[model samples]
Target chain A: MLEALLRLPPGPVDLTALDPAATPGLDGGGKTEGKAALAALGDPLADLQERLFAEGRADVGHGRAVLLVLQGMDTSGKGGVLRHTVGLVDPQGVRITSFKAPTDEEREHDFLWRVRRALPEQGYLGVFDRSHYEDVLIARVRALAPVEEIEQRYDEINAFEAEVLGAGTTIVKCMLHISADAQRERLQARLDKPEKHWKFNPGDIDERARWSEYRQAYEIALERTNTEVAPWHVIPSDRKWYRNLAVGTILHDTLARMAPQWPLADFDVEEQKRRLREEVPVR
Target chain B: MLEALLRLPPGPVDLTALDPAATPGLDGGGKTEGKAALAALGDPLADLQERLFAEGRADVGHGRAVLLVLQGMDTSGKGGVLRHTVGLVDPQGVRITSFKAPTDEEREHDFLWRVRRALPEQGYLGVFDRSHYEDVLIARVRALAPVEEIEQRYDEINAFEAEVLGAGTTIVKCMLHISADAQRERLQARLDKPEKHWKFNPGDIDERARWSEYRQAYEIALERTNTEVAPWHVIPSDRKWYRNLAVGTILHDTLARMAPQWPLADFDVEEQKRRLREEVPVR
Candidate 1:
């Protein structure tokens, strides 16, 4: 079921063919069981993260890391996924970068410049709430760049992900698939709640007006950039619970496959213990 | 009680005069009560952080932020304070940077250049596990830089901190003070436990040999760079519980004084709510 979501086939991708409301990854269980499954993953996820962090600290060069890129339409529950899924791990082992509009200085460099700086160090889990894919997604929808430049970015991103994967970083890109109806409901809720008004931007309506164009952009992005090294998973995000579960499962599986072990210490442990116990003078 | 820990007086300071084990900021509460007090601060700290984050998002220029700089020797529990004290707030509102030995690129720039880049954006609580103070602390003790360069850094740091503080950023610098006896016990414990061996570096012993020199370096730093905008606090860290309590209290108090409020909405609330309810057509 998860394999169906992975846009791994080398063919033209059609966003219209996929149902955003489908929960193919879930078992027969509903939201209640989905929540329970997510809860069950907590301990093992933390344990795996500890081993990963320990591996990074023990050996820098051989350390492995994971980078999860989350791209979605407005109100697609990126914040919720961050709070529920990524928040479960130790903050020490996680590095999250929430990309906003680029700054003047960032604009001076290539799009990948700021991104390379924010990559997770060895043995850490790096998350990008919105990532370099924005160059192709929004840039394409709004025609911010020349059509040729936007065309160039898809290949550039593919090459970039290949380079990072070669350096022992696993990449998982998830597009939080949501219907326009779901987005409208979420945006309306944000406007209705005074506390949430801070998150509601009127510009989102304008973006929604260009929904078809954005969908076209994402379709092209998924088709062009999905490679064997880095695949894009179109998660059914209409249900926030299932979205969180799928992401958590993906991370758990990735970390388990990496199977980072505690690195062996350089010094003689018994000798060091003896020295600490007997020879070290306490002031 | 917290007043006693603040080095607010404008005068020469001596590190030897301070007691590393005294719980000056904590009341008559022992470790048990200190732990409870730290736990008790969780909600209010989270609340204050939300307001700060909201303000940053609503208005970029007018938003306020806090930068907490923690400097301590090996085994002084900087990692513990981060995991326990700073970890209480929402991760979105907090930016934690653990600065190691500078990279070759970082070394090419002025010391403050890398630091300036890492400063928390408006509405964030920025924490430096180890910070630029290393320039004047380790660099001074090890004579890594020239005598004149080390001396110049004190003023340079003061100016740099003043510039940040002037821009609506409140800076709180903490020196986690642990006695040599406490440090020996910690380092020894790390060596005795195989899992902790990764954290124990052999060069720490060489640093332990120059304890007095490092203390002198800290003394000069606290005296010369402590300013009206950003003051230094000597935290008695021999007791982990009390250390967490003191740091948490300092943050709660500092944030209370800053008093970030939820920003007022720019648009008409009722109109937006009505539009969301009756006007905007959901597809």
Candidate 2:
């Protein structure tokens, strides 16, 4: 199962792989290095989209269940990936669930209630805009739970996701790795642009102040929860174009490996032709 | 603009056209008469699904906007149509918005703001599991609004839907027509099965008592809002199989007419051949 998901060969990562000790914008982390990574992503956006859509369709037809969970900070381009990626595939076989503040009834239940209900059925792809990882991420960052409780939830989430995967749901978890500087730039752009103003939240600036804490929480979340069943991809998202292409490539490659089966022809041509000859009126 | 929208026929509907007013387990409703209508649907299952998926893809390609609104009372088979219809289309291009209780921000604005944001972009389809019509249907049936306010809402909804359609969005409104007896049977089915017990609600029994009032509201909604631009299809959903087939057929047909364009091929055979010829080494 693990071998099936490896589509693209491991290339050199574009960014300094999340080294907190490294000096910010030092020689090792120059702007030119980022550009080189973007260059590494192949050109021609339209062709890439077409290939992704075809791969997703074939996987669904094969009756192989695949679930993609997008977990990231608010400005981490989760919505952008959803809008652009789904724009390529047919909507029939896909379901996207955006988890918001839990309802009174939902709050009474465990966090997984809403998420479990939103999982894609067999022969479908379900995308969670944010998922159960929140139980650990938010709980750890905000100290919503006791330290022991927070640590315990990780095992529960891993077990829960493993069960889902065991039941034929292939899981792909993506953590959009954006730096503090990039987050500030995106949030500011949302405020600066009229159409994107709806996306900007004044509270997000405060969240940005505690960026280090959030980054620590995310790093822990990835390190602890990353399993063979649902390994997390720390996608470099400073460049939105490159981020979209990288995620798109991973998804396209994964589905191609799953190789969903299509239905066989129901009728033979000779039999159908003979029946048509007997039943038809003169044209 | 309205005239052009009106020119498009509501397409295939009334899965049980000959069996109108038919209730489940009742001989008088001419229930079996739906055979011809079901046959008219053409695609038994796969064909219907294929058409629905193809048309949805076409709408996205042509950059033709489409909005589908489904509304009905309890046990009206809203879930059935949604399950079967959406089951066939590509899930990526489709967005299903289920309007439950409004949020704090939603309450601050008019009912349409959240809905406006949910509208499909160019080359996409937006599905309303329940729509703004709730302001009229539920409000009127429950006596939650004054008679004048309810009447005002009907007109507002009609105009609002027409405006969206004029802006190049194809609006398809389907009212699942399940008989009163059929609803009781369905609600009971939920209660009888252990797995389905979660779906059972005692409040549904009380709602059945006010069935006539709900019917009156529906009749008015159908009459007032049925314009040439966006007509309501009263699908006879007492027959589950027929209901799925009819709704699927109409949606497929409407989308087919829009004719979405596919991504252009980018691989140039001539250039490839020339490059190959130049690169070929003499043995």
DockQ of each: 0.40, 0.04
The candidate that wins on lDDT is 1
Candidate 2, after superposition: displacement of residue A66 in Å? 1.2
lDDT of 2 by residue, A1-283 (tens): 2223222123333333553122222245444553453344333322332333333333423335678888888788887677555434444446787676677988788777878888876656678888888888777878877899888887888898898988778887877767766666676565445434435445565566566677778767776787767777766666665565556666666766665333322334344334333432311
Once fitted onto the true fold, the runs of candidate 1 whose alpha carbons sit more than 4 angstroms away are: A1-40, A60-63, A274-282, B1-33, B60-63, B274-283
Tell the DockQ for candidate 1.
0.40
lDDT of 1 by residue, B102-204 (tens): 9999999998888999999899889998999999999999888899998999899989999998888899999999998899889888877777777877777
lDDT of 2 by residue, B100-185 (tens): 56779887877678888888765556788788888777778888668897888778877888888877788988777777657766
Q: Model 2 scores what on Cα lDDT?
A: 0.61
Q: Stretches of candidate 2 above 4 Å error?
A: A1-16, A19-63, A266-283, B2-94, B97-125, B128-171, B174-283
